[model samples]
Target: MKAYFYLLFLIFSLTSHGSYGQRPTYSEDEIIVKTVTDEMDQVFKSPDFLKKKNKQFQDITGTMVVDIGIIQSGKVATFYKVENTITNIDFINFVSEYILQHKFKFKLPKKMRHKIRYSITF
Candidate 1:
């Protein structure tokens, strides 16, 4: 009897996960990227992106990966493990700080953990 119950639980678990994998409407990564882009625009659209550069200034370009944690309350509670960035530390900190301070327009699913990479050229 115990063995039968375990088998039943396994099948149910697999089927439920399979359902979540299908995203005929806006894959999770797509939603995450869109949300990040929109949030970043709210800040970087100012003089920040269009600031005049000095001769010594160089544009930094690379993809930055961030680990985000969303709580069941429909809000982001953590942003960490910034990676794949090959720019100055100041720039990385600036980007990371902006991400943490700004809220994504989309409310993530309950108890969701997401990671995404965004290209930066500035």
Candidate 2:
């Protein structure tokens, strides 16, 4: 009886002390923006993209603020809006199309839809 009581106590203590495996929490600025920034940098720094950008958008210089909405699944971007500062229509269209066609690799919990603001500098 004493051994059974001790074993029960041990089990209860261990279970209570165990972590419940909660999902990691992130600040919006830290994870979401950084993920977008990293992906944008990777895409823009590629030689092929660079060549095209230089050929077509060499003189373009401005900052574009993008509002991106992430789906609840967080693996995909639901929609995005570019607050354009540059006057080049073609450049704006290209950037918008690129964003629209791309899927984000970073994923978050499906608890809620997430939105983030990102800026691109040229």
CA shift at 54, candidate 2, in angstroms? 2.3
Q: What is the lDDT of candidate 1?
A: 0.58
Question: Model 2: per-residue lDDT, tens digit, 15-104?
Answer: 987655433444475777787778777876778767878988899889888876766444446445557688987998887776666666
Clashing residue pairs, backbone N/CA/C < 3 A, model 2: none
Query: In angstroms, what RMSD does candidate 2 have relative to the true structure?
Result: 7.8
- Model 2 TM-score relative to the real fold: 0.61
Question: Each prediction's TM-score against the native?
Answer: 0.45, 0.61
lDDT tens per residue, model 1, 1-122? 99999999999998888766443323377776676566655556556644622222357766666665544343456767556656577766766665566545455554555655544445
The regions of model 1 sitting more than 4 angstroms off are 1-28, 47-87
Alpha carbon lDDT at 1, candidate 2: 100
Worst 10-residue lDDT window for candidate 1 reads 49-58
Per-residue lDDT value at 53 in model 2: 82
